[model samples]
Target: MAFNYEQYLRPGKLPHIWCPGCGHGIVLKGLLRAMDACHLDKDRTAVVSGIGCASRLPGYVDFNTLHTAHGRAAAFATGIKLARPEMTVLVVGGDGDGVAIGGNHFIHACRRNIDMTYVLCNNYIYGMTGGQFSPCTPMGDKASTTPYGNPDPTFDIAKLAIGAGATFVARTTAFHATQIDKLIAEGIRHKGMSVIEVLDDCPTAFGRRNKFRSVVEMMKRFKETAVPAATAAKMSAEELQGKIVTGILHREERPEYCEQYQQVIDRARGA
Candidate 1:
């Protein structure tokens, strides 16, 4: 049976602002599917986003959504989670929004092990603003700001999330459409801070600057480079070089921040 996505979307929110052939739309569909798989209640679920192309997602979704300031999605979502512990909070943003300006907020949320899911769309460049190089942009990649080629090292988002204490960390590319929803559903089901990095494409911004002829060419790169975690385990370090390891990379049980805060309140009352 064909899944009906209209129920989860707002009326007249069509014609999303994303450039043609951009992968953000693909990620959006995967998110909606994951929401359905998790049986998320529109009333009880809150989707928050910082300013970016990916951040525009919440505006179309029929849920408790917040289109917050640039690079502040994690901070806003943290507050929402702390206030309404029962609500399922989800954060969505691009690479620049999640790890550049919002990097501190993102790491702290992970360290606290807050009960929320952050879906980071890593398109490698600042697509909406300008074709600026982001933290995740590959070294030597061309961007509007780095026409001479990016000289800085790129961030490994999954490893960063795992290091920062995210209890659940997963990664997949937009090319792997089926895997996107599966990983997102798993992240949503996890108790502690969950970060799902979706490697997407910005054809207009990143791709054109990097010499990708079409969206299909960009997607082909993802398909060629992505390796499953289980498969990666069997490969040597040299073999895994430049490979995007997909699937659940890390997961662990931890004391959720809200539960601990509740204990503090109880102790204060007793005192």
Candidate 2:
């Protein structure tokens, strides 16, 4: 039986604009499924995105969606969650949008430990604005800007989120569809800031330049190399080299930003 995603999607948006082999659609689908899994009130959920291929997600979803400026989805989500603490705020964006231009906001959001979620679609390259080497682009990877190869070391997105003080952090690839939904659902249930890094594919731009023969090859690579966090812990660094770590990396209870601020206001009121 086909899973009907029409209810979550906006009307008259039947045909999405994503490319044939793009994995952003799958990430969005997993997010919606996670929303359902948590039994969230759709009316009270707000989705925000920055300018990029993955950022276009909010426009097609039926929710309080904001298509914001480039690399500002985290900032927008922080504001929305603060203004309406009852609402569930979710920020979606690509690697370029989240870590390149928006790195400041991203780190600070995690530092704040706000009651919100950030779903980062790390496709390695800047897919929409031609294939540019993003902050997450692996060393020696080819992009339009890096004809010879990208020399800069890649950012481990999950580690960055943890280092920045996110209460909850997880990583998964497009191949791990069920894991994506499971992690996002858990993130939503957690009270503090959560970062879910989804290593997705952008076949048209990233794939062609990186020498991926086909979408199948790209997906097969993920299946072979993605290691669970628990398993990775036992393996030596040399043994786990070139492997993508999946599963929840860090999680801890924290006084969410809004609640802490509210307490200060109440104390000042002397009531």
CA lDDT, candidate 2, residue 252: 92
Q: Looking at candidate 2, what is the lDDT of residue 14?
A: 56
Residue pairs in collision within model 1: none
lDDT of 2 by residue, 190-266 (tens): 99999999999888999988889999989998899999999999999999999998999999987899999899889
Candidate 1 — worst ten consecutive residues by lDDT sum? 125-134
Local accuracy of candidate 1 as per-residue lDDT tens digits, 112-172: 9999999999999999887899999999999999989999999999899999999999999
Give each model's whole-structure lDDT. Answer: 0.96, 0.92
The model with the greatest TM-score is 1
Q: Residue 148 in model 2: shift from native, Å?
A: 1.1
- Which residue runs of candidate 2 sit more than 4 Å off their true CA positions? none
Report RMSD for candidate 2: 1.0
Worst 10 residues of 2 by lDDT: 1-10
Q: lDDT score, residue 38, model 1?
A: 100
Model 1, backbone clash pairs (residues 3+ apart or across chains), number: 0
Q: Which candidate's lDDT is highest? A: 1
Model 1 misplaced regions, further than 4 Å:
none
